[model samples]
Target: MTRGNRILLSCIYWAFVLYVFVPLLLMILMGFKDSKFIGFPIKSWTLDWYLGVFSDAEVVSTLTYSVVIAVLSTLISVVVGTWIAVLLEGRKFLGRAAIFGLTILPALVPGIISAIAFRIYARLLGIEPGMGAIIWAHAVHNVPFVALVVMARLSTLPKSQIEAARDLGADPIIAFLRITLPYLIPAVLGASIFCLLLSFDDFVRSFFLGGYEPTLPVLIFAKLRSGMSPEINAIATVALVLTAAIGIWAERFTRRTNKDAKP
Candidate 1:
C-alpha cells in the first residue's frame, strides 16, 4: 500500500488500542484509590479493598461458586458440542442443515433475548432458578463455540489416520478414542477455556436464573446498585486480571499444542 495509507492505518490501530485499554486502565487505577468514593484527584491509595476481597467470606464463596458453575457448564458443552461436531462434520444427511442451524442458534441469539427465553423455559419446566438452571443455560450458550472450534480442528485431521487405525483392526470407537480424541485435544482445551471465561463473566443469565446464592457477576451487580466505589473497581479489576491470565495461558498452550501435533 501507499505510505500515507500505512501511516493512517497505524494511527487507527493505536487509536483503537487506546480506546479499548484507556477505560480498563482507568478502572484499575480507580481500584487503588484510597477514598471511599470514585473520582479523580486521588491523593491517597490503599490495598484495603483488594485485601478485603480475599478476606470477605461472601466474595470468596461467590468466586468459588462461579468457578464451579463455569467448570460444570464447560464440561457439558465440550461433550455435547464435540459429539455434534463429529456427527455433522463432512457428513450429509437428511435434516443436517436444520440440525446445524439449531445447534448454533443459541450463540446467534442476542444475550438478553436468550437469557429471557431460558428464564421462561426454566419456569415452564418447573426448574427453579438456581445452579442447575444457570449451568444448563450456560452450557447451551457455549456449545456452539465449542462445536465451531472442534469442527475447525477436525477439518484439519488427516483421513489417513482413521483409515490406518481401521486397517489395524481397530473398531470405530477404538479409532476415535486413539486418534480423533487425541487430535482434538488442542481445540477442546481452547474451547474449554473460552467457555469457562464466558460462563464466569456471564451476568444476565445468572441474574435471571440465580437462586439465593449469587455468582460473582451477580454479586458485583448487586453491589453496583448501592453505587460505584473503589471496592467495586477492585473486584472488577481482580476479575479482569484473572480472565486475562486465563486467556493468555490458553492462547500459548493452544499454540504449543498445535506445533507439537504437527508432523
Candidate 2:
C-alpha cells in the first residue's frame, strides 16, 4: 500500500476503535463521579459507588450466580463439544451436513426468538426458570461454537499421529488421550473462554431463563430501566475489567502453547 493509503487506513481503524470504546470510557468515568445521575462534566469524584456496589447484597448474590453459571456452562460446553468434534472428525457419513447445520442453527437464530422458545420449552418440561435453566440454555447455545473451533483444530492435526499410536498397540481411547487431546488443548481453552464471555454478557436468554432471578446483565438492564446510577456503572466497570483480564490471559496462554508446538 502507498504511504497515503496506509495513513488513511490507520486513521479509519483508530476512528473505529474510538467509536467503539468511547462510550465505555465515558461509562467508567461516570462510575467515579459523585453525581446522582450519569452525566457528563463531572463535578467531583469518589469511590462511594464502588463501595456501595460491593456492599449491596443483591448485587453480590446476582454477580455470584452469573459467575457460577458462566463458568459451569462453559466447562460443560467445552467437554461435550470436544467429544462431539472428536467423534465427527474425518467422518463421511449420511446427514453430516445436516448435523453440522443443526448444531450451529442456534447461533444463527435470533436471541430473542431462542429465548422465547426456551421459555416455552422449559414450561412444557416442568422446569422452573432459574439458574439451572439458564446454565443449560447457555451451554446449549455455546456448544456449537466450541465444536466448530475444536473441529477446526482437529482438522489440522496429523492423522498419522493417531494411526501410529494405534499401530503401537494403543486402543482408540488411549490413542486419542495420548496423541489427539494434547494438540487440542489450546483451541479448547480458547473456545471455552469465548463461551464463558458469551454466556456472561448475554442478556435476553438469561432474562427469559432466569425469571425471578437475575444475572449481572439482567440486573444492569433492570437498573437501566429505573435510571442510570453510579452503582451500576461501578458494577459494569468491574465486569469489564474482569473480562478483559481473562481474555488477555487466554490469548497469552494460547500464544504460548502455539509457540511451544512450533517445530
Candidate 3:
C-alpha cells in the first residue's frame, strides 16, 4: 500500500477505536461531574462521587466479591483449560472431537441460556445459587476460551522438542513440565487474564447464580434499575480503567515472553 493509503488506514483504525471508547471517556468525565444526574458536558468537577463510591459498603462488598470470584475462576480455568488443551493437542484418541466439542459448548451457547441451565442444574444438585455457582459457571465458559488459545500455542510448538525430551529418559510428566509447559506459559497467562475479565464483567451469569451476594455487575444492574447516578459512572470508570490496564499488561507480557522465546 502507498504511504497515503497507510496513513488513511491508520486514521480509520483510530477513528474506530475512538468510536468504541467515546462512551467510556464520557463516563470517566461524568464520574468527576458535580451534577446529581449523569449528563454530557460537566457543569463542575469534584471528587465527591468517587468518594461516595468508596464509602458505599454495598458497593465495596460487591467489588470484593467480583475480585475474589474473578481471581478464583481465572485460576481454575487456566489450570483445567491448559490441561485439556495439552491432552487434546498432545494425544490422539477416539471420540476426541466429542470431548473437545463438549468442553467448548458452554462458550458457544448464549449466556442467558447457559445461566438458566446452570441455575436449574445447581438447584437439582442441591447447591444454592451463590458465589460458588457463579465461579463454576464462569469457569465453565472460560475453559473453552482458554483451551482454544493454549491449543493454538501448542499447535505452533516444535513436536521434536517434546519427542526429544521423552527420548532422553524424561517421563511424560517431566517432559510436559519442561518442554510443553514453558511454551504454553504466555498463552496460559493471556487466557487467565481474559478469564478474569470475563468473570468480573459478566452480568447475566452472575445475576442468575448470585442469590444473595451480588457481584459488581449485578450490583450495577440493581443500582441502574432504581436510577442513574454519577456514582455509577464513577464505579464504571474505575472498572473500565482497571480492566484496560489488565488487558494491556497481559498482552504486553504475552508478546514480550513470546519474542524472548524466539530462537
Candidate 4:
C-alpha cells in the first residue's frame, strides 16, 4: 500500500526480468554485431551472419532434423500422455503409484543419464542411434510432462459428464470421444506446444542419440567448440526468439484458461 513497497516491488520485478532475458538479449545483439567474438563494444552491425544460416547447407539440414523430431515426438507424447493421465488420475489400482512414478521417471532423470540409457537400449535392440532413437527419447521425455499438464486440467474437470454420457446409451469409447476428449482438447494442445519446445531445444539427449545426423543444438555446440563464428550467434538469436514467442503464447493461453475456468 505504501510508495516504498510499490517501488521495491517494481525493482524486484525488473531485476527478475533482466536476469532472465539479459543474457539472451546479449546473444541476439552479438549476432548482429560485426565482431567475431562475443564481447562488449560492438563496433558494427551486419545481417551477414543471419544470411550465413540459410547459406550453409549443413545448418539448414540440421534445423530440418530438429523440426522433424520435435513434431514427431510431440505427437507421440500428446496421445500417449493424455491416455496415461486419463487412466492414472484419481484411480486406485495395485502398483498405480509405482506406474505413475515410472511413467514420469524420464523427466526427473538427468539428460546425460537418459542419453546413456537410450544408447544401451538401442544397441541391445539392434537399432542404431539416429532419427528414430532421438525421436523415441524425446517422446519418452515429453510424455510425463504432457500427462502432468493434462492431469492437472482433468483434476478440475467433473467426472459426472462422462457418467451421464454412459448412462445415455453411449459406450466407453463414445463417451470418451464425445465427452472427455473434447474437454481435454485445450490442455492437449498446450501440452503439445510445450513438448515440441522441449524436443526442439534438447541438446544432451539428442547429442548422444543423434548418431551420424546432428540436430541444430548439436551443430551449435560444435561451432562453439570449433572457433568464433557469428553464425552461431545468429542461430542462437533465432532460437531465442522462437522460444520466447512460444513461451509468451503458452503463458497467455494459461492465463486465459484460468479466467475461463472462473465461475
> Model 1 off-target regions past 4 Å?
none
- As for candidate 2, its clashing pairs are none
lDDT of each: 0.95, 0.91, 0.89, 0.89
Model 3 lDDT at residue 175: 91
What TM-score, to 2 decimals, does candidate 4 have?
0.93
Per-residue lDDT tens digits of candidate 4, residues 1-263? 99999999999999999999898788888889886777888999999999988898988888888999999999999999999999998899999999899989999998889889988998888777899999998998899999999999888778888889989999999998998888788799889989989999999989998888898888889889988677899987777777779989987997787787667
Question: Highest lDDT among the candidates is held by which one?
Answer: 1
lDDT of 4 at 86: 90
**Decoy 1 TM-score against native:** 0.97
Q: Count the backbone clashes (under 3 Å) in each candidate.
A: 0, 0, 0, 0
lDDT of model 3 at position 144: 96
Candidate 1: lDDT of 191? 99
lDDT of 2 by residue, 1-263 (tens): 89999999999999999999999999899999998877878999999999998899998999899999999999999998898788777898998888888878888989999999888888988889998899988998999999999999899898999889999999998988889998998899899999999999999999998968799999999998998889889999988988889899988998898888777
Candidate 1 or 3, higher lDDT?
Answer: 1
Ranking 3 against 4 by TM-score, winner: 4
User: Which residue segments of model 3 deviate by more than 4 Å?
Assistant: 1-12
If scored against the real structure, what TM-score would every candidate get? 0.97, 0.96, 0.93, 0.93
User: Local error of candidate 3 at 48, Å?
Assistant: 0.5
